[model samples]
Target: MGADRGRRGGRPVRVGVYVGCGALLLAGCASMPDSGGLSGVESTPRQDAQVRVFAKSPSKDASPAEIVQGFLEALTSDDPQYETAREYLTSSASQAWDPYRSTTVLAEGPNAEAVHSGTSEGTAEILYRLSGSKVATVDTQHAYAPDSGSYSRTVHLTRQKTTKEWRIDGLPQGVVMGRTDFQRNYKSVNKYYFASNVSSETGGQLETVADPVYVRKQVDPMTQMVRALLKGPTRWLDRVVGSSFPTGTELKKGVKSLSPDDRNMVTVPLNQKADHVGQGQCSKMAAQLLFTFKDLTPTGVDEVELQKSDGSQLCVLTEDQADGIASHGTAHYPDYQYFIDGKQRLVRMPSSGSDKQPEPVPGALGDGDKKLRAAAVSRDESSAAGVSTDGTSLYVGSLVSGGSLGEAVLHSQGKTADDRLTTPSWDGQGDLWVADRDPKNPRLLLLQKGAGSPLVVETPSLDGRIKAVRVAADGVRIALIVEKDGKSSLQIGRIERGTKSGEPPTVSILELRSVAPQLEEVTAMSWAGDSRLVVIGREQGGVQQMRYVQVDGSTPVGTAPSALTGVKEIAASEDERLPLVAHSQEDGIVRLSSGEQWQKVVKDGTAPVYPG
Candidate 1:
């Protein structure tokens, strides 16, 4: 659903199911190579010595006028040589288009006439008109058939400017096929060309002619525009990745010498530095996106940031109210601020739009509403952790208002104005998945809003606390990180079609021992693919790190220390290899698309806000 592309832009109209009933007309249009500008009539002419002489036969030796007459005669006289009409056309005209694929020369009137004139370019133009009993053929192999309707066609013939020889250039410009009314007795020239590949059932469509070539002409500009638009929510980035970050901030900033594959840690010289308020006690980790404001210079948007653990410097700076930061409570308004602890938190920025009530679709919730209520009562938030993609309504988590640990399902889309889930993650499909901790059980319960039943998936081990849960594709798999025993572990599970609960449909647990040991709790979890996961934050070393782990067996497959020095926040690009890192020294965004080709898109010290 997220990958859907836009169709043609125009006024919507109800089209009939069947559209092949209209009469097909013989109209002419032209296809020419991209030609350079033509000179004035007085420009020197280049001689064309390649013209072929006609044979002595009466039909072959006919002049341009006679040749046009013969073409008209064959259409109405039913002459046997009609099939061999090619014998009379000039070699240039015959080679211009594939007769088998070109005009079928259907029916023409016996009174058809050809008018010829010479142009300044030394080409003779021909206009042919006919009506009644003209010869026509559907395809090359088919015999000419008699037809009744009268029709007209205009053709262009170019003579070698120097030799005064003529040849056909086919259709003229004004008659090409396009949108027009069918009721009128007008003939529109239409051109159709097709190519196919066996690898796919359908072939891609490409226009033979496109106006304003600018659309496809500049590749670099288009690439930059697309990259900028896809730079997701910016406000959230600033929240998570702050200005002054620690040395090991997973997302780092680099200078002109940055590489393509360096994921974490960027280096910057003081002279060309970003606006850094010096290093903070917290570990800064950020994923920086090279961006440009609509009216400003190039900048980078940090999507995720891991601030230092110490309390000296504030990791997030935003207009969001400060109180919401301490209690994990709802923001007073649309934007708010807060601090992040050791737990891994995935924060997505809110989109641009007015504050409208969430709308609820009756069937969208399925029969799970009741189950959600029963299950939410056991958890504790007053507001549901998830909502539909439409934003029409909101779902209350099992845990709300510090209330009793029982299952409860509350709707906030229209009724409640205050409490709403913070940092919600969507499954790419329509369903939203949220994380809720169970007081009695040490496991984290995943509250799903769109499933048939109010759904919940708990971590296998009750010893660890669940911090984050991410869904892949359309609810196919759920990836989460659990912090237990001062260590963080990654968990993967699949959703079963009919199951209600207990040991989720299919589950696998992987502990993050390699990255951190004592306080090695996971800080962030991002899914690069179904089998791959990227985790940020540190454990024992006090140094922030970005680890790429394969979920198949719960182990680390690769690790990249952000070359970015003094990192603040780390955000991963859609491509797993390229990680954007923010630096603390100067307000800068370093892109690690590779280990060698590092480019700084934003050098401003503006820190992005993450879900605190």
Candidate 2:
């Protein structure tokens, strides 16, 4: 249930994409090599097994040292068959290879030996020595069974008769180690050692070593002290201030005596506790820290903002978004509030008082009894469907699902649910134009301020498919896509207020090939200026492209398609010099500002555009 709710809020809204559950088919392995089903070296099964072990075991293990050598050699082999020395085991080894088998052997004596063993079904049992190079005894138990007897095994380094050499091979039920055991063994081996698997339960595995650098296997007292002071929360402030001071000792009355040069160290944290010592002490500490450049930055701010501060605008440094406020600081921690400067860098601390305001709530989108046919809003949330220029009213078209089209209404202030309009899209001036998608008699509905029974202009049969419909700023021209004969084409119409022209509005076909021969269909169309448009679509070769078209009822000057290939979305700026185009597969938004020089202004996931 939690996952379902998360999907609703965290998942992207799919306007044209459909998602569904799927299944993955697992193919069975090829039939085992048939050697007449013999039992030993002659049979394909038995030979394959022994061959696998031969591939893994080191060439020599004649002595105790050879056992460690053999173990290291086995680990170096990346291939599981070679790494496991599987062929060396008896036929019963098949049971040991199953993944369901998860178990470890922890034996402590003079040797303090520990071993981990587990298998991933028919695959292999991977193991490593957790601690104690020398072996004394081995204890093994199954992960699925606690009552199972502990298998006692011994290591016997012997020479290979066939190779006429010594090697650690053909040992039965040997112990090995895994990741979990590695951590356990590391701590047990070094009493002073502290290590943690940084891996998340569902993510990748990482290991952090404390007190000593475990990998290089080196120990440094001073470096370890600094690392602990920096990361340990409970003892952090005390350890840091203590080490920096010379012969400092705690005194009565909530104070500590320190050397003159190190006095500032204690003063910094004390100044922060102003209520206990008074504002005068806090100000003195802040001033001192600033002058010494210890922890306080020159901008009179802490590293991060205060907790629970309200009404903070989150940073969104994308090309289409608003710039950050000046004289403020940058925020890195989650849910933090800070003030930043014009360069988008941290500059000042956020106001830390009770006057913090609440995040503003948008006005409720009124939903009336009127039915909605279609709706579209501006990409930047700058305008909604059918909003008035003054932002006081809305143009709405109502049609009941599976019912006849209803009248277009211009809605104003109201709390009544029955008074709401449907299918709202606005022009540059807030004049909303909607469409009644009546399969039988489709119509273009218009709503303007102070208008009643909206001006409905009957439209041609758009077959059964309508892609998109939007209006120009002047509210006199509208652009839409209508499908006929299973093919879509761009259609433009004139929208006149209160005029029953008695005739269909003038329509024109936007032929991209005639305009730019390489173009195919128009997937997106936006007005570049008063009389120009920016269209995005694929070319005849199925390569996505962007073209600029001038629509003044005259021949247009066709600029070359965007030099940047694979353009999926082209957002024209108020100045055309910086058109932002998004590439879905490349997962980056590039600004075409330097004339064919594309700069990756925003990275992927800022706002992901679904690929077609």
Candidate 3:
């Protein structure tokens, strides 16, 4: 029998009967002999399992409007090939369409309607009204850039006589996904780039900075991200950074794809032209790839192998080896808190555990009766800029003991002290920035370290006044708090270096972008991290609070830690790990508590500051 077949069986038995003594009567008795009944069994058959799969395809009788909607909706799916989405388009359209060209992120579902434009019944048009802000756009080069505003698009459709169904005969080149779908289908990743030069303050270490960009999570993100890195930094960052990839360089033709093998090793084939490059340069290029793809799912690529077009290995780098070739600088903060002490003298609060009392900094500004109101220390901690108590003169001098206090570098233009200069801020380049809020000649000023005169930085015409100005570590961006019509706003402006060279290097404000639009009144703000700011503001008719917001005017998700009440002035380092220090109305100067609450760190201190 076959292995699947069951066995058939039967049972047998014996019987006893009476003798045939009586021949005639025994004939009936012999028939009465006992007998056992017969028994048997049969085999049963097995059934095979059935399975079903669903294919998302265009409907045979879909209308022109439906075809357009279906194509847009299909974009949110995990089908990276977008085969089903192609079903809604004609063969020619399908072949010409390039979904990777760009992505228009809409606020919500698009409103699409069919419009009979021409006399022919085979042709139709669908007008899509895309409401809400266009938060961002990903270009063909895969550079994600922030854009703001609203817009509309029109998608043309056609019908086929044989199928009697509508298809997208003409449409936009790129895909459009709703915000919800965008969040699900795309991920934000940072590509590393080196600063143009080594930091003057830190001996000679390469400064690696992260440039955040978005990529399709399900697509061949490794390839896409590498291509973007090879394209160099975005336009905004071009002037401030450098890349390892040589100019006019790109991956070899016919070698467009990249993927990790079973061992999590990714091989990148470049053009034969790159074969002439040296090993050190090749290692830098490989390091860029390793860092860019470090956060990918299913285990990141552990090692990267770079190859020439001929398939010869140019260089191979493991993650550990890459780390040794590139590194980022640590956050630079002053060792002590510099502020005005109770005696109206420039003093330093011990940041470490060794000191028991506040000590005055060395300098005539700290020893003499100069009566300083505000002070700022340079990133190198070698020099200091101080404002007078009367707010009439701004002085600059050495922080060392017995150092001469220079003549006033800036003077108040206003008659009253209220319109004088606010706190001064120092940029990484050693230039000092301050805003002269003097109503008479209100403007921003930039002073070169040893320059005799200060360069005037133009400010945008506003109904309100410029209260505070803070320069970022990059030295190319500035944050301003403007008060207009009894309301305050947090604004970020790019510092445009003047083309005409002068003693102080002429500078001006090109434009300003709002950061915290929802805040009714902004009290204070400091650069907490790269591309992020810690702001203390109050909502319209609400209490005062502090929160973290992106420099692009987007609020970060999740509620912020407990708000610091009665905060008069706040200061923070570029490092987010550093605790926030603030001068409160009730407790003087304080830092964040272990539980993220505000606790007093010092008494009788004001206008605390840290290096930018």
lDDT of 3 by residue, 421-460 (tens): 8889988768899888887788888887724688888765
Q: What is the lDDT of residue 369 in candidate 3?
A: 66
- Give lDDT tens digits, candidate 2, residues 362-434: 2121132222222333322322233332222443322112322233244434233222232344543334455
Worst 10 residues of 3 by lDDT: 1-10
Stretch of 10 with least lDDT, candidate 2: 1-10
Error of 1 at 78 (Å): 76
Cα lDDT over the full model 3? 0.68
Residues 351-384, model 1: lDDT tens digits: 1222232122112122233211111111111122
Candidate 1, backbone clash total: 100
How many residue pairs clash in all the candidates, one count each? 100, 24, 0
RMSD of 1: 27.9
Best by lDDT: 3
> Higher TM-score: candidate 1 or 3?
3
